[model samples]
Target: MDMLDFGSPRQTYDIRVEYSLLYECALGIGAFTWDEVHDKLDIGQAQVLQIKRQMSEALRREVSLAGLHHTWRSVLFLIHRCPYLPSTTQEKHLPVFMDWLKEIKDSIRTEAAPYLGASYQAPLAAALAGNALDMQKLLDEHHENPVIYQNLQYLFAVSAEQLLDHIKRLVEGWYEEVVSRDRNVVATLEQSAAQTSALSQNVSHEKLIHTVTRGGEFVAEPGVTTLWLIPQVSYRPFTIRNHLPGYAVYYYPVDPDAQTGLDKNRLISNIAAKHKAVGDVLRVRLLELLAASSRSLAELAQAIGASKPSTHHHLLLLRTAGLVHVDGGVYGLNVDEVLALGEELCRLLKLDGVKAAQETSQGR
Candidate 1:
């Protein structure tokens, strides 16, 4: 007889919805750093420029002095490293985060020393660890990688203490001047998180992640046991993925419905955008290839006989329309969204009246 054996229990994870005004404060500042040609930021260029101009001279001076526009990603690292407690306000967390940064300033410099002047791909983990990388080399080597190389260059030039001080002042000033003025932003973030939390209760983890990220997939690695889903409006139209020790984090775009509350015009605009995305012959061809199988930019370009830039532009439109999703650099069609187009149109036009009438007639 075989020995009696008990198998190991399967590892599982819990998804938690969290929101903080601090995140919005940092991301709002980061938004100014986005490049028009590459980043698909939902905020119009004119709006972003106008917002920047509206900032107080002191706040604007700190932003420029700290080179926050170049090293803006550093603020994200600071936020993630800071311990968070649910329901804590930005006021409560800001001082604590700054103190923590002060305590670890030396260690940050130590960790960063090895990478300075060395050629390496700038990984988010490394950046979070305070590494000062060689941006020029990174650009030369990985031309296609979408990173603000100036971030690394700025890190290399500044001392860790200086960097931390600059970031602290910038964040505090931002919260006071920008975030505090708009109480509605905090309410919006909280409402979005609550709505997403409700949806998560009824959906499976995979389905919830896919829906929230607009079709992006998540594959857990070993020892990961929790997912932190944060709904944000500052980084609208972009779902940012990040990681920390034993936890995977997603700062996803808030749903339009949560923001606008059943506005028919917004619905119509969304439908029109989707139709426009599919209108181009080249885009249709790109979708045809993606429908058959997932592909990379180079692969899709070759398949459609288009240049990389042209192919990327078409794919961007499809992605903005929710018909395409890219995960880990591989592009795939969002079949569910594609299939729902007809139903969406019908609902928008109130054609559901016919179905309701037929159902009423056939009812017992």
Candidate 2:
């Protein structure tokens, strides 16, 4: 089945400029690598091999297994879902690439069957095991807010080295495998010649010089040839810059030499204490939900996908933390203290902005 045939694909998130990534990798943005892309296509075949083993067991339609995969298609489906994860922290995209190979398994079932045999999944799985990109996390859940830079800042948890290495390998491999092989030069030269002919007739863009190639030199080869894949990159200026310095402001860090680090634990604890009385994802979700609408314990549980007992525990924490107030059967922002909460959040955001600005200035 075509994965994209379901309709316009679901709204999935993307961390970077996805097309740029595809251009760099030589595969579609969501495609797997050269060696491993076919391997994912074979994992299903491996599953079929397993299914073939159990065919003689007529008494059972299913064989119990870890992860409880009941059939080959289900296994394929699971792999297909692997690329829909929430984080992209893999040190290398090569490792979990097999996870993406799930998509091509269908292609392997037909035209690619010869190359994608039983041994195919082995390399694919190996690539997955070695991949640095989290096959389960980074696939489609990247941040999408217009504040793209803030979304990047949210990824500060990731190390810079991992990002750099993945991009470097991806771009280099793409250039070697897909880009350099194109014989665009001859085509371009020919097209340029065609233009040359047109131009010898005084056509536009004719240097009025026929060009020739001898000893690997295009000595103005006296002909019009269109150039193709001429590995030349240039950028046109968006605007002419006439630097008329209208204003300049000099700012210094409050303590340029001060060494400081944000203690995530303390930051969470402080925010929690100030807001939810406890800094936690659940409580934060609760605050957000409450801010929008008053809801009962059951509604809270359903909204947060937590068990009643779990939701209760969190509600208790929030109530005790004095961040929430319960009334009737609904829980929500303490109507009386809501203003204070807003003030606090605004102050915090402002403070963070100031600190960020200070750091940026100091870096200069």
**Top candidate (lDDT):** 1
lDDT of candidate 1 over 1-364, digit per residue (tens): 8887798876667888888777877677767655452246665664355455445566787777544434445676566666543545645777776677777786553332222222232453355454445344444554454344555545656777777677778888888766674546666777878888898889877888899989988786765678899888778888887665567889999876666643465567767878999999999999899889999999999988999999999987787677887766788887867887787899988888878888899992
Stretch of 10 with least lDDT, candidate 2: 233-242
- Candidate closest to the true structure, highest TM-score: 1
Residues 101-131 of candidate 2 have per-residue lDDT tens digits of 4344433222111112233444433323444
Clashes of each: 0, 39
lDDT of 1 at 350: 83
For each candidate, what TM-score against the reference?
Answer: 0.56, 0.21
CA shift at 364, candidate 2, in angstroms? 14
| lDDT for predicted candidate 2 compared with the true structure | 0.36
